[model samples]
Target: MKEGSRLLDEMNDRSREVFRRVVEAYIESGEPVGSRTLTRTLSEKVSAATIRNVMQDLEFLGLLDSPHVSAGRIPTQLGLRMFVDGLLEVRDLDHHDREKLDATLGAGAGDVGGLLDRVGAALSGVTHGASLVLTPKHEAPMKHIEFVSLGHDRALVVLVFADGHVENRLFAPPPGQTPSSMREAANFLNAMIEGKTLSELRRDMAREIAARRQELNSLAAEMIETGMAMWEGEADNSARLIVRGRANLLGGEAEAEELDRIRTLFDDLERKRDIAEFLQLAETGEGVRIFIGSENKLFSLSGSSLVVSPYMNADRKIIGAVGVIGPTRLNYGRIVPIVDYTAQLVGKLIAERSER
Candidate 1:
């Protein structure tokens, strides 16, 4: 009869305890929990008949449901939401989990790109769900540079950053350009970018090239200038996304309808538009956030849940997010702390990188 949050407040203490026990048991086994089962689990000395009466009252309140007349009851989506928003007891992240995250993410701290992949892997491992890691734009010192010819006067500039990020930029070659000249230009520009970022090179590029004009022919110089000019101006603000452990979403105990929902969820994951929307969810508001089933607009039909926390930089600006994706029936009490701790570690990593 009462609304979600208020229902907990209005519920009699015995009724509330019985409802909580039912939701916990159902979440543990994904089965309808009988009042007899609650009688065993509840610390209070309650009789099975009394618990059954409470369950009936709960079902009447729209917080619980029974699949059959004599079978046990399960919490509805609204019921689960109410529990998560109120009754769930989330623990602090344990020391072992903190160390594991450090070891996993810090495997190769210098390789920021590889670290992003590991972040996804660690999140999936910890939360038992598909992980979506949204990485910020790649802007780091140059590690290596190469120019590959794509024919038809088109060439590809493959850039390897010091922080393990690799990017490809396309450019058209100038007239009279040959393989030898392109190689010569690559060697010359590579030397100029050893400790400099793309932005720095763009700023002092003309002067640097003018000084080395005698080393390269007119055509090679023109080619190098054209290639470098393409990378000038602001770096692309587009976030690079990493998706891992999608297979983990499969092979769970599910009915035909639930199986269909999982398939629909996979289909949504493969869609660019849906993925973009999912990423936007991580950027919404702050702290650790949870979206259960239909509350998540992108995968509403799939009946999926997302537990995410945004990681920020030294400036407290949210740089990215680390989170998990799974079915609606997940262990929120356990996963919340893991996600929150991981996000904090990621934020610290971002801060460390900025200082370097």
Candidate 2:
């Protein structure tokens, strides 16, 4: 083999042992490790000096880091990435794990919203970390729209789209509006805005109303604006985020100061748009994606890790992603395959649902 390939092969074999030790030490103590610990604990018969030399080589290759002089080495983000990609070994979920997940996720058949929440909760519970599920944005083309008037200047806007998706948005009308005006606005939209995307509808309505302002009554125009504005906000906040088990991060393994930091992290997650955008990056890729340490800007401050896998629809279109976020010392060998398999399970379930 060529020198590069030979080096790669050697590194592959050697790093497996190194990565195993690094992961175990990190998990047990949540601290960086030195060669002495590995030399003492590793089953291999290497001397401490020899282990130190190998660790230096690993560090030179960017997989290990020495946080302090004379202290043990820790797996850097790049090291974690390599371990996940090349060294990690994972097994299928055991029967108990499968049973737990199935019971939690399979509880609400045919209810996509409830199923998503349950999946998030189950993932978080199993991982003992915060879990996130990104739901598919409504991509179906608009088939029809209708507005129903309610009392107190409020109206319900029902949107029917081509893919059998229906959503209702309640719009509060402008002050002093009546049922007659609301009906007029709805009729105008039904006649003019069928088969339009939400953006198209908004733009066309603005242009048409601007041109015909002189011919229309003020109440009708105001009602139209109200209805358009209602769904517009919904479109902007399109991506749905389901998060569960954030409180699980509070106690175990994390220090008191770390808990405070995690509380802020949970607060940030409550702002769904941020987490949605973060998962959006993961949904663009195939297979499992690992964000280690500073690799992901959002969780860099917390020194966290995220493993995500994109879920797809029947047409092979990526619709969403599911993942777990935890401290960087997480077991990549174990969690990577778990997240990936769960994503496949989710995709299969969604496909089955679409068929039904």
Candidate 3:
């Protein structure tokens, strides 16, 4: 049997009942649950002394903890994991939420950008936490490319992909470049952008430069090489990340003591790298993944939780991930299926668009 199941079995009936009550109480109130609270909540009317003894036993087993010397007991991260794995009674996705997602996300496949926006917003609203969506590794073919000078030796590369997604990338021009040379470089790249991904475009550029370096002027060659190298390295290597519903974290019954943690959370959110790191924990997994506090180091400062699931294409290959970031006290049973169902919808919509 699994370790979690075996741990559950090791507990006598009374201890198990008290442990479940404490976990549920923590979920409901985000506070340490004391023996008196469990005494009032549990259906079997166990005495406070008996419940206290059981709590100490659970603490000894590494399942429960006390924040202060005198504080009530709360489920430790390991305890949460055991409760989730062994006792979490996950039900099917709610019919109302399913209909809401279908109505909101069923269409708009042509514009992947707008579709992602709706997805982030819907997840944020339904789960009452921040939602994160990582765009797939840019498989769409390049349809067009433009170089616009930003007037500080910097230029923006406007890329239009065949999947109707547009993105902008920036690169610093090598010293002593001209607009005409920029135009020449763009013209060269445009010729090869058709039906080719960024990776393909890089290969084509490398070949062209090697075989015909003399065919192009010195400045244009530098621009072409520099721009292509930057684009391929930056765009292809990093998946675009979308985050929404940050304000929800600050809303509702936020205790004053939690303000510092919330501030830290906002800092983590502002750094896209941290959010990406949280989702990175899910990239290798199969289905819904749960990373509680300390499990996600980047968010551990804020005591946050990450629940993500990989969205797949029709080929059953993982295209991207979608999920929420909330306090560690998230309603795991409810939010887990919400994220799973959202990922399925996202994958289905992408697949439908691909069939066209």
Candidate 4:
């Protein structure tokens, strides 16, 4: 048996039953589970004293905790992790949810970015929590490249991908570059770099440029060099992070004291790097990745949990992720399958598009 299963096996029947009830109650109310409530909630004939003793014993085992000196007990992050891994029953999406997700994702057939935005919105609406979608930075080869003059040494670099996606970025051009020079640069790049990925172009650019240097004037050559330099070592931001339903983090049955934690989470969200790093870790694994409260350093201060699942491409390689972020009490059994299905749907859509 695995470690989680072994741990479950070690618990006595009463301990296991009481622990499960406490977790279930906590998940439902987002509050600590008191002995009086457990007496009424549990099917067993155990007295309140007996249930309280069980709660303490479970606490000693690091499964439950008390939020206050005289308050009820709540399941710790460790307890929740074990409960999800060992005891939870994940169910399939119902007919209604299936249709909803299908309609939402199908709306964007060939537009990958727009599809991912819908994925994020769908997840957030379903789970009543913030949703995140991390899409692959490079999905298709370039169909065309152009540099348009925007003045003040700033130029607009427009990239048209074979997938029919157009992305434009404002970049600083080399000094002394003109509209004519930029057009020359665009013509030079489009002639050689079309139909190739950024990675492929990076590999052959130096050799290609060196061989053709004599044919290109000094201004055009400098513009080309500067444009290439702008993209180096910084394009990884292409792994886009789309977040929705942030307001869902507030309201509901949340306690007054919990507001501080929510505030902290709001501040944390401002740091995209932190959210990006968390999702990157999810990409390393298959299926759904669950980080319960303190298990993830990013949300520890806010006592939040994240359910992330990586989406793949036609080749069965992981390409991106879609996930939900909410309070620790968010429904895992329901959200897990929803996230998994969404990831699979995204991968399927991408695969179908690639085949064409």
lDDT of 3 by residue, 1-356 (tens): 76667889889888888888889889989888888887877878878998899899999988999998868999988888889888888879998888888888875555666787899989998888898887777777989888888875898888889989888877788888888888988888898789998778888889999998998889999988888656544443346677899889887878876767877876765654354454456667778988888877767787778889999888988867898988877899899999999998898888877788
Q: Write the per-residue lDDT of candidate 2 for residues 1-356, one digit (tens) a residue.
A: 53333444676555568666876677668788877788777877788888888888887877678879988888777767666665566776666767777787777676767778888988887777788788776756577777677877577878887778888776577887777776777777777766776667778889999998877778989888877755544333245777787777776766777777677666666643265456566756799888887777667666778888899989999878898988777766667767887888888888899899
User: Whole-model Cα lDDT per candidate?
Assistant: 0.79, 0.74, 0.82, 0.81
Candidate 3 Cα misplacement greater than 4 A, ranges: 1-9, 43-45, 107-110, 143-166, 171-196, 199-238, 274-279
**RMSD of candidates 1 onward, in order:** 8.9, 6.3, 4.6, 5.3
Native-to-model Cα distance after best TM-score fit, residue 276 in candidate 1, in Å: 3.7
Worst 10 residues of 4 by lDDT: 230-239
- How do these models rank on TM-score, best leading? 3, 4, 1, 2
By TM-score, the better pick of 2 and 3 is 3
Q: Report RMSD for candidate 4.
A: 5.3
Number of the top candidate by TM-score? 3
Error of 1 at 301 (Å): 1.7
Residue pair clashes in candidate 4: none
Off by over 4 Å in 1: 138-237
Per-residue error (Å), model 4, residue 211 = 18
Per-residue lDDT of 102-190 in model 1, one digit per residue for the tens? 88988876655677788999988877688878776555787787888788578888888898878886667777777878888788777
TM-score of each: 0.71, 0.71, 0.77, 0.76
